[model samples]
Target chain A: MKGKPFFSSVVQKLVIGITGLLLCGFVAAHLAGNLLLYSTSDRYAAFNKYATTLHDMTLLPAIEIGLLVLFVVHIGLTLRMQFQSQKARPEGYAVQKSKQGRGALAARNVMHLSGIVVLAFVLLHLADLRFGLRFNEAGLAPAQTVLQVLRDPISAMFYTVGSLLLGYHLFHGFQSSFQSLGFGGERLTRIVKIVGILFSVAIAVGFASLPIWVTLLRK
Target chain B: MSESINVTLKVWRQNGPGEAGRFETYPLENVSTHASFLEMLDILNEKLINTGKMPVAFDSDCREGICGSCGLMIDGQAHGPDRETATCQLHMRRFSDGDTITIEPWRARSFPILKDLVVDRSAFDRIIEAGGYNSINAGNAPDANAILIPKIDAEAAMDAAACIGCGACVAACKNASALLFVSAKVMHFARLPQGKPERETRVARMVAKMDEEGFGSCTNTTECEAACPKGISFSNIVSLRRESMRAQCSGRSTR
Candidate 1:
């Protein structure tokens, strides 16, 4: 088939939407696992066990590699698309107004910026617990190291803000993924939008709750 | 009561495509509130011609707004400040006296400036030529009621057919994408039984042409729909995305 390139504009957008939705799914699963921090019964024994179990899994490396591919492809396509869109209009208007409401415009425009913040926070998170960079790990449990990282005011504040920005990113992205993939019906779109808002709130509050908890009661 | 308004127009003036363009201010007096936006331009053009100056060049026909020939970026808003109204349909009553109205052409690499406030929208025509019709000869015209289409499909098809191809969607889109226009054409036929034959190849070829023309990708901001004079919904763009993918998968001819 002598067709268009595999990565045409439409196909680029299709891949981006797929990868973004997959990342959102990963974030939800990660948030669920992180809730083990609230296990105060065994002094975080369950949380530590969960961490160790995840580390010892045979498929952990493959899963991590898959996740890295998703992030790289998703973020790479977005940067290229954004740059091309800017070039599409070399000379912009002297004055321009959004027929779309100002608030909605701002939300869609800030996707890349918010995505950057979420990426940085995720890296910071990995440094603290995954790589043991924040504290000495000679005899420390993952939960204990997590507490040390969250105890630092700067780290806690960054996590809180980053989590909120993630919610902001997903608010448009969750519904946007379906549209890009051409998944729509009369009622399906409205339902996806409503659910997108709820999911965004759940993720933001769920992740931010950790730092707040460690800062306050875990002292 | 009808009234007259004195207004200043900051119109974009470009001598040629390669030449640098600038805004020239013209203070017009005694413009009738009942006059359409293009009529105000006519008054200004007459004054310029009377003074032996080159009048502004623009596109307009069927001043009643059906031909999709008139478009302008007035005061930063596509088709002026009215909702679902084309530039030709915008009346001066919406403006107050002493208002400074800015006029510019559609700014996009694909839609080049041909003259003052007039762009070369032939790129849209090229896309239409790519594969926007059913050219097959299946005999004479069939009876109107011979083809039985469901009511919902007819309404949906009509909704997609509302696109007038005025290029306002392109002008107002932040990405300067023409997906709204392209999708409208795709869905216009795809909703009815007559469009199913060329559905796969049509989307593929048109999308390739759109990319070749350097239009940006859709980000689903719904800005295009808001700018559309006919109020064409953004959902057509979504359906086009599906149609393109479907073509790549099971089409008889890829090109």
Candidate 2:
């Protein structure tokens, strides 16, 4: 309407915040499914069966298409925001010092943390889950079979490291998402922050337990 | 104890905008660590006046730091070594004996040098004038609690309002960004019930004024937060963005 009608900073924040939260939700669901690898022998098989049902029986193709759309939008919005923020500071300072304020250092570097999480997800997560899901359709023997796969030194190490990275990303993403959605105020914000911390710890511990249980305690 | 501290002051002296500016050196004797940085300046100014020399020019008022009238770059910093404290509120104890201090006015296109350590920060006022206030004129009285607001929103508004309008944000910023300052004003009123009537107009006008002032955009370097006396949150900037988009798309498209 008035002034600049196209893309603005608010749009950039909204897109980043919403997309980040959506991706967080996806990660939580994925982690829940992975935890089933610790259950009984039939449980792991049933998990794959559910995955097959969702993929072939239902409209999963449509869901993947939707996910693709969201991922594209999120990446596009993040690039624009990065460019604007870069343009804002053309002359870099000699000695740059910043305050922690009421926010944490991890929260301030969401862009950097997200980059790490995405990288680890691609290299390790793909090998363990996505790759297995695609090629090894013979089906897992049981939860113990899934555990045996993860018990490898490399797999366990990557799982432990990757889940930590995910937790770091969620540490900031949880509180930031609420602020972005305009749901944060005094009272709700306090509750949201407590829940955010709890979520971060839960995701970290829940995901890390997979590697630990499989590698050390499973035998 | 009154310690004999040898402090070297390199203060900028400018007769006017068109005149030449130079860093004048002044050596002080027996300066106490208990005195405020401004009080030290006062002592130097008093000596200059007594010796028939023109006192070094600077701006200061309400030394308590709430007025935002006192500000200067000390040792290449917006408000000296202290974090989140105004220049007037900075104590001499932060510095050791024989420390050399460099003081200069805020350097930004919007804040032109008027003289010495005093610059014309009226550009900030103009930005506020552009649309930082409410225009609801009423003839009758309304109940204080007529419109209910959540305590969270009120606290957030107060936090945003804590901005003292000091141009330290511009000085700390490499690009001379006004986002922190502009966002502080925008978020302050937007969070309140009384200011809701002019939310769209305020954002539109304030942002335009900021651009016109030749201030750069927010690159997220976050130096402003480091320099701010109130320690204003960056989330306020994000909040400003959200409100700006909503205002632009709302019914006030024409205005």
Candidate 3:
């Protein structure tokens, strides 16, 4: 087999790893910022203020553009890799069983299955909250906007499910990104895995609780 | 001495590459349990020959398991039931009386079946040719102390070098990825001082060759590690990724 001049599989994996980790960072930061909505004082005044500050920040557009590029590149490369991997095995075995416990079932298939779910959720989330395209309840506070969109049981359910799926995706994607980047040594890998699990749970519970809090307890 | 047991073998039979294959079952009685798996196959072939039927075809050399030539997917596990053992090392004692054993060749896009239980593993050779070696010449045999490699580094390099290129990892992987095999060779050289000169280019070129050979991308399934006969760790793959990233960032490519 002759070497190709283009991006090798290693480079492709690096791209996926870097972009995936960046997205994970964004999710963590976003969840941390959103956690401010649960503050019991002033009816989420701090949350609205935080949103205004973000909107008013001069670098917000640049960050958004960067995020757009990252999302596009990450998803595109992942789909391409998936297609190539599928093509590599034209005929699968009659019986197959996974022998390794390093990765859980959620981690093994998360790239393909949860990826599509997360992508769809991200689009819906952007439309409902960010762009004000679908659930455009104008003149409401940022917290109220969240409440307005999540007031519908179906929307709340979708958000909750999406958040859970995102957790599963991040649970595997976090440490996996590090592995793809060649981060090793027994101690380091163990720590990274523990951190990955914590991060996944935090993001999932944080995001999922927002909709549940607004819909059920915020009466 | 182990007692003999009667058993039936369900072996995959194919006329040639691209031809449809099917399992052909053969029953034998009072087979010695102490015999190696290949020896059992030899006995079966002898019977087939005596019966005026075509004998089964398989590959094996250096029956001691170091040559990396003997391989078969027995009962859905690569290189049979024993852990860290090759097909040549697996004994019939692992089976029980009246057990039905299924054997097939390494199934992968890059490894086409040449006949029953024999596949074309030349893709591994191509990957090695791509960059699995150090091109440097030290001129003469230098003193052993001249290199002064750290103990940890030397051990790690030796561990990576244990890969036998048997392709069991490929057969076991759900995606049929050759990440473990390629990474073992890449890491073996990348960890030593002598491999530094061409390190960056070697990784890039070998990875390109792996992809060109139609091997699937590694999704960190870790199946390859479990199936490896030489116990080549999955960490080699991580090192390969790291080396590949370094190569890309440094803009080094031998292509």
Candidate 4:
């Protein structure tokens, strides 16, 4: 009733849901920009230009700070919800039956599990490409840095696996975010779910294709 | 008619609230296939009374399943195995001979165990008391046909109203979320013209009460729907989310 930041579980879920959708949008945009690395016309010139444009933008720092806040709030609320749910049932049932119509087991429980994996991958990825910390030369083109990283089997494997995990996490997180925001109606829910699946597939495949294409196909 | 079968019931036994509980097995033989689940329990109680042992304490009333008083987790399924059936409506014939059935009370932080197989469901009552009623002055009853509600709205309202407050949804949810229960009441009231007057207050108050009662948040797992004896849809939770947000954003509160 009072105007407190932390009110109830429903309000917490609403915050988490809205922020989650915002993060989803950020991921989609990020993937689109990353895909420019595959442009054939220029020898990584276009990709470097795109990276420079993003870096030069005055709003970049503010956007980065906002993203950091979103991640912290989303993960914090999610962990709290998980802990409360766990405590609600302290004792276990002798024989438990699996629920119906809830989708795959991985999709249901992937939030916490895949979330950690994606977090670790993000840090490593930023270090390698965003900060150019792994490269001896600091001012290399974005494409060259990406190529250099993917050329290593360990980095490529991690990127590939991380992309797949991100896909799984988004696959459920997308539609669930909509539902949490109270978007309901038989037809609308179905459409949201379909769009969620397609978007998840696109982001995952798009990001994964980068490393695979750089390592195997690009001359 | 199906043949009668023998069953071994591993029922949970607890002395009282905050007391340690354990499974006590009772072998019931030649239970009538036509007898309802409560009737079978009655037979077991009769045996216990004759043998001078304390009878298993369970809650039940209106053996036809309308009162919402009788419920038990049979073999880990809320309200027994048959879909859309309450425990009182379930027959002993559903069980196979020599089957070991594990019966337990509704385990939830909100609904504390009062004794063996009985929990204090006052939390649900408090949630209802929070805002489950419409404010109407006492007067001559209005004509039933005066407010002609559309068939679709009436049906939807009835669907949500079918919830008997049995607490099966809480019992079955992995998170022990009462979203299904709260949502049903929210939808039932929100859909009717009579209930529109206090719709905002009803949703906000009920949700707050549900949280205050120590229930967990709904992660949309939907185990509650699968276990619901009344077949209440999980979509109501979606409606509840929308309604609650609308109220909060509008800065409306009855607190």
- Taken over the whole model, the C-alpha lDDT of each candidate is 0.89, 0.75, 0.87, 0.87
How good is model 2 by TM-score?
Answer: 0.72
Q: Which stretches of model 1 miss by more than 4 angstroms? A: A1-4, A103-105, B253-255
* Local accuracy of candidate 3 as per-residue lDDT tens digits, B107-143: 9999999998899999999999988987888568678
Q: Which residue ranges in model 2 land beyond 4 Å of their true spot?
A: A1-5, A96-105, A131-155, B1-30, B38-84, B96-126, B134-162, B169-180, B187-196, B205-227, B230-249
Q: What is the TM-score of chain B alone in each candidate?
A: 0.97, 0.94, 0.97, 0.96
DockQ of each: 0.76, 0.11, 0.59, 0.59
Candidate 2 chain A: worst-modelled 10 consecutive residues by lDDT:
A91-100
Candidate number achieving the greatest lDDT relative to the actual structure: 1
Which residue pairs overlap in candidate 3's backbone? none
Highest DockQ model number: 1
RMSD of 2: 5.9
RMSD (Cα, Å) for all candidates, in order, is: 1.8, 5.9, 2.6, 2.6
- Model with the higher TM-score, candidate 2 or 4: 4
Winner by DockQ between candidate 4 and candidate 2? 4
**Candidate 4, residues B193-228: lDDT per residue as tens digits?**
888878889999999889888888888777789888
Q: Report the lDDT tens digits of candidate 1 across residue range A1-219.
A: 365566678888899999999999999998988899999777799888998899899999999999999999999999999998898999999999887667434768789899999999889877866776876658777788778888989889999999989998999899999999998786999999999999999999999999998889887
Model 3, C-alpha of A11: deviation from truth (Å): 0.5
- Writing each residue's lDDT as its tens digit, candidate 4 over A98-196 gives 446444365755578888888888888888777767765767776777788888787788898899889988888988898899999999999998999
